[model samples]
Structure formats: C-alpha cells, structure tokens
Target: MADSQRTSEPTNFVHQDEIWKAHVKVEKDLAKVWPNKWGFLTETYKEYERESLKLKEEARMKLPHHLAARPPTPPEKNIHVSRSPSVPQTTQAFIGWRSAHSHLQLEKYGTVHHGRRSFLKELGWPLDACS
Candidate 1:
C-alpha cells in the first residue's frame, strides 16, 4: 500500500533546446578555426585514401558468401614429444651466436657463423615465427 502512490518527475523545458544551441555554437566555432579555403571544402584526407584502398578491397573480397562456417577438427592426443641430441646442440649453438661475446663463447666449435633466423631454424624452430 505504501508503494502504490507515485509522483511525476520534474522536467526542464529548455534542456533539449539548450543542447542544440550548444552544438550549433561549437560547429560555428570549428568552422571559424578550420574554415574552407577559397570556398573549397573537404571533410576527408588524401594520404589515407591511397593507403586504405588496398586494405578495403582485400577486406571486401574476403567476405564469405555463405553464413555457415565449418568447425575445425579435433587435434590428435598421442603427439610425440621427442627431440634429437643435435636439436639441443643446435639451440645452444643459436643462443651462443647472438651474445655480445658469441665469437669467444662458441670458439670451442672453431666459428659459429650463421644468420639469426637460419641458426634458430637449424634447431627445429619455425623460420617465420620471428618475423
């Protein structure tokens, strides 16, 4: 019984009108600050046009025609987790190659001269993972 009765909420009559006026005022201020030159107006930028066109076209082409997507197959459970002796040796070799004193460090093997990616890839790591 106590919650049965309710009163109407008070409203501001000029609230919405004031908001529109503020927006118009801001727009006019912006126009004065960054106005068109010689009556020519441009809302968009130029460099972004060329840069975005390729990405936009690629995105447009990638859209699938069908709505249903095929679910991925479950992974195998009994995957082997073995490594060869040479793999560890290669990994240690790779680590030694990147250090400041790498030349002195791996001097036991004469010289460990190799590219950063190639040295790591020789140890069973993917070549493209770094990039």
Candidate 2:
C-alpha cells in the first residue's frame, strides 16, 4: 500500500478554502513580525543616495576652475560600416544565415538523453521498475 501510494499520481488534498486560509494566516503572521519590512529597506536606500549626492557635490566644488568652467564634450559615436559587398544585405539572406547558424549550434550541442532518469541510468541505477 505504501509503495502504491508513493508511485501514484498526487491528488489535491487541501481544498480552495483551506489554501486561502493558510495564505491569509501566513500574511497575518508576516504583518505581525514586520509590517514596515520593505519600507525600512527603501528608507535605507534613500539615505545612501542622499550621502552619495552630497559627496559628488563636494568633489565637483574641489575641481580646478578651468576644468569646472569648461562645457562637457559629447562622446564620439562608433559607426560600423561593412566592407564586404558579398555579405548578406537582404532580409531573406540574413534570416537564412541565422537559421543555418542555429542549426549548426543545435548539431553541436543538442542531445536526446537528459533529465533525472538519464542521470540515474548513467549512474547504473535500474529505473525500469520505478517508471
């Protein structure tokens, strides 16, 4: 009977109301323990941010007059221009290349033998009776 029960498919032992009651109880317990748990963490983060901003302001004030007066220059944008004209330019050709790449990747890595059963089989465990 114990072995049969172990092998059988699991059934819903707890009803909807029971699950709801349990959830509500857990929430109530959490509220009792620490109602402002998330609020405390947020307040701590805000304090840290305030300190960081204050430090940044102090650093800016300490900078040399010439460096502080000068306007910040925009970063240069890196534009990539493909030199090869024979490379796939059309959408269809690009898609075909992508598909081929994916197929090659699958061929290199994909395998059928996997999961817990496979692992057990590799370790010389007889899983035929269990299944």
Candidate 3:
C-alpha cells in the first residue's frame, strides 16, 4: 500500500552535497534578480550621511553670532525663611546643631543633608555575619 511505502521511507536520504548545490542555485537566482545589492545599499547610506552633514553645517551658519558665542547663565539660588509665634529660638537652634554637626546655630535651613555611611550596614553593602 502507498501508506506502507511512506512509513518505510529512509530517514538518512538527505545528502550534504545536494543541500549545498540547492543553496548555490538559490543564490544565483537572487543575483540575477538584484545585481550589486550590497553596493547599492552602501551608496544609498553614504548619500544620506552626506546630506545630513550638509544640513547641519547650514543650520550652524544661520545661528546669530552672540547666541552661539555666549554660554547660558546658571539659575539663582533663593533662600526661604518662616517665622512662628510659639516656638522658642533656642529649641530650633539645638535641632539645627544636632543635624549639621556644626557648633554655630543656623536660622534658616537650606536643605536637610545626610553624611556618608561610616559602616557597611548603613551603605547597604552585604556582609557575612555568620563568619
């Protein structure tokens, strides 16, 4: 039966030489359809790069001389102070001294800052506690 013949087909029928010849044939067919494919792509990319460079040069030339020469100024720093009716000055000064580690008391706080970690645990570095 045809079903029996299909079931008994040899598994090792494919040869490396036949596969290589088929590959060569496919490449030849592609070459006939599109000759110098890689060369055409390279030329198109080069043309695009050339046009981009030309446009950049033209844009640079159009900018005003003073705008191009001078650098932008940095933003001004503003300090804010708040006055409260009930809170004593000494209490606020003590809190500032504790946070800054400085002897002089600060009236207006700029930013609450943290010091660098002295131990591995503070910096989140892993340590073997069992050993």
Runs in model 2 deviating more than 4 A are 1-10, 13-20, 31-33, 36-41, 65-131
- Give per-candidate clash totals: 0, 0, 0
- Per-model C-alpha lDDT, please? 0.62, 0.70, 0.68
In order of appearance, the predictions have TM-scores of 0.22, 0.34, 0.34
lDDT tens digits by residue: candidate 3, 1-131: 89999778775546867888899999999988674555688788999999999999999999998769676555543544344334335865655444353323363466566665546686676766435
Model 3 error, position 3 (Å): 18
- Give me the overall lDDT of model 2: 0.70
**Which clashing pairs does model 3 show?**
none
**Model 1, span 25-114: residue lDDT tens:** 999988787755523334355556766998999877887867446676556654443332333346657653534354334364776666
